[model samples]
Target: MPDDFSWSDFIQRALPLAILGLALIGAPLLIFEPEGLPRMRSLSKELAQVRAENAELTRDVSKLRAEVRELRDDPAAVERIARGKLGLVRKSEVVFQFGKPR
Candidate 1:
């Protein structure tokens, strides 16, 4: 054994602590932390929700385009839509109205 401990003893003690400090500091970036983890998960959920809504909107757009094409090619579909949406009646047809209580 040596009578006096030198700088090597201090360095050997510090090396483990330095490694532990680096692990602590780098863990949050490499692994998920409690504070930021929930935010990242929420962002992923929101992105999924937005993608679903986008898909729904895209389907709605395609459906509307198909309806527009139908209205352009089929006069019967146009007439049906006009009668249903605008309450249009034929030249000799009489429409009866019944009131319902709200």
Candidate 2:
């Protein structure tokens, strides 16, 4: 048994260094590892963006479904799209010509 260095003193001195070494190892794992905290945060942001995009796509699908239903079931809907988008007119309708100013 050593006179100056006891078991209690060795434990006290080595405990803080051991803890610090563990903390140093753990910090790199937390910040830089592939499946670490930083990756989890990145995945969280990606998940939010995907959710928002999914919501927007859902809304667009709903709108398209409604438009499809209207165009399929309503003659007026077809006529409105034709007249507005295709510049179509019936045989008996008068046509007007407008010119842009130079």
The lDDT of each candidate is: 0.90, 0.95
Q: For candidate 1, lDDT tens digit of each residue in 1-102?
A: 577978899899999999999998998866576557777888899999999999999999999999999999999998898899998989999888899979
- Clashes, model 1: 0
lDDT of 2 by residue, 1-102 (tens): 667978888999999999999999999877888888778999999999999999999999999999999999999999999999999999999998999989
Consecutive 10-residue window with the lowest summed lDDT within model 2: 1-10
RMSD of 1: 5.4
Estimate TM-scores for all models. Answer: 0.60, 0.66
Tell me how many residue pairs clash in candidate 2: 0
Full-model lDDT, candidate 1:
0.90
